[model samples]
Target: MVNGPSTQMAFVEVDCLPTHRDLVVATLCRVPEIISIEVSARGRDLLLTVVTHDWTALSDLVLSRLQIDGILRHRTSLVTDIHLEASDWRLDALNRAQTLEVARIEVHSATVPSTVTPADTALIDLISHDGRIGFAELARLTQRNASTVRRQFTRLTACGIMKFRCEVSQESSRWPISCTWFCRVEPGHVAETVRILRGIPETRGCFSTTGESNFMFIGWARSVTDLLRIEKEVAQSQPTLRFLDSAVAFATPKRIGWFLDQSGCATGEVVVPTFSTPVSKKH
Candidate 1:
């Protein structure tokens, strides 16, 4: 859930010992730094989204910490800049008026303290488990006044430490295939290339990174054939963009904080991210 330039994020592809696959996954689930864990269909065993305070912290996690017994080998791609985040993904479900109404409330609570407190920890943990929990229930669980819980909830969302999103099973949605592209864009054309990709409706998130590929994006498609069309669209728009690799996710066991079932529905099993509680907007 961390953002801004001070925060470090990377996608790591891990190849685990086949005999210990299940054990490896269970162990990774407990690592606070590991966020999104994808069980790929092929080419890799697991793909992880890991976050840390800086490059040094990231190196420590990747080089030292992630070298678990079952993990045979791994590749890390450090995200240098984020062009489009999941929060920026628009489903276009809300009309002008309804969107404006929601914006008004968000604007009112736009500013919050940069540092987290003990009270914030309790509130964050509760909400991370169940986003639909009522303010009264949160107050009861956190042992804070109802009004105080409400204020803290607003502040958490406003400061970008936590985000609320509504997701449906990709199998049921119009775009059923989940695609990720690892690409490299000429340094001078990075911004324009990002602009082009962001305008494309299928894009879920896009980032500029350091590794074999300098840019990468997650996109959705109606069918396997459509992936070629997306590639053509990007190639046509930015001739300098080169595709180094691509993947189609078979199953995502964990995303953000929720553990999903095969159908991509939340299973009520939550792993409240350890770093999410005290994310500092400033270093």
Candidate 2:
């Protein structure tokens, strides 16, 4: 059995200085098992998903280190996860899912049957880490041939089931990091508006929903003013949309397509450190 990361996801309640939230997240990224972590609205809480040898060890780490951060207030719930092990067949099936049936727009439906295998999934997970991992590294990790891995990568990307991009980490620039603005768009005109939204290079991710915000999207802005320009462009492009609310995330504890959690299991890369206590001081 792979026995890798087959545990449940968790939502941890946390409170901290609005100024220090990002710092806290950057710190938590050290946890080895956590696949993803993100900040939420209202007080302060971080959504975390991690793998465990046993769920109990996972719980102790959460309470002992994360909750005691002095800067954080921690409340955790291990969400029920019925999904089984990750498989290439499952992913290929998802990609093969019909267009109208596909839940997200980024997932364009396919006509051909899948050619992906378990080795391919493993390889993609590897290169996805640095966003620039070479084929030889992936083959070594998954024990597959280099040429085979390259073919799988091309097919997977060509199938739209995976993606990779140059990371714009804060270390690269002092300018404000980019963020996406999710909107509670009124019903109707959903499809029409998405087309307009994608026209902009700043746009990175987009999806429709049935919640108060029916459509969600991410875009990059160099500054507050640039952010507004993107918004204005959105307004002008989709005049029919009756916008309800918008959330401008100054800092993202998590990215839109971050399959990797705090830990780097998605890529079988580095293990992100973790604290098993509250994240911030709850005032």
Candidate 3:
């Protein structure tokens, strides 16, 4: 373990009320130090690789802001940090998280394949700590074929169940991808708030977790200032929400999707079926 105020990416687990799920995720999106926000089976949550010195802040975020609306229970764990991203560990962890439950795979298991298992849990910790890896690096991490990695990624995203996009590093790129930040809302209005948020074209994912914040939200913006303006507008628009604090991210450390699991990681463990596209290619 990296001693002192610094951390080595530990998985944080939060048990949230199903209704408050979306609100929790939407709130965490803007936190600057948070590396990534994805959904999974450990229950709906925003798994973040918090900066080593900033881990305490994460606790405050979950408690003060994330403890409202529909949230019921909150738990935290220190699963091993994998030093990778969600997309990179998708297939490998899926096989491992599942293996913990049974001696063999069965067709009738009720669990969705997308939730992060203990095996992937370790990878999640790593991505939280280091979300800046590539396919070649990930291939080496799991010792898998590059073709297999590519195929799994394409299949997962094409199915519309999950996806991973290139995120430019902070200040390195003139134009960064669109995004959002959040503040906690009163526990009663989470559902209403989410309905409004999802109505926006840019909002991508949301979740509820432990700490001062009760929610985390992420979305695309045309520019940095554009995202800031939107966050401000949201505060004014939702009076019942009781906004507490917020942050805006320039880069992420890790994330997960269908190639790794399902839409749950991005959207609070909501079951999303595989994407079905009309065939346009010649047979």
TM-score of 1: 0.88
lDDT of each: 0.80, 0.51, 0.44
Please report, as a residue range, the 10-residue window in candidate 2 with the lowest summed lDDT: 82-91
Positional deviation of 76 in candidate 2, in angstroms?
16
lDDT of 1: 0.80
How many clashes in each structure?
0, 37, 51
Off by over 4 Å in 3: 1-180, 253-283
Better of 1 and 2 by lDDT: 1
lDDT of 3: 0.44
Query: Candidate 1: worst 10 consecutive residues by lDDT?
Result: 274-283
RMSD to the true structure for each prediction, in A, is 3.4, 11.8, 17.7
Candidate 2 on 182-240: residue-level lDDT in tens? 46655567666766865675665565543444555655456667877888888898876
The alpha-carbon deviation from the true structure for residue 73 of candidate 1, after best TM-score superposition, in angstroms, is 0.5
Give the per-residue Cα lDDT of candidate 1 at 72.
Answer: 95
- List, residue by residue over 1-283, the lDDT tens digit for candidate 1: 5332356889998999999888888888777778778887777899898887567777898889887889999998888888987766767778999988887876333543556676777777777777789999998887779998887777777777666776776777788888889898888999999899888999999999888788999998999999999999999999989998887888887888577888887788777766633444545
Score candidate 2 by lDDT.
Answer: 0.51
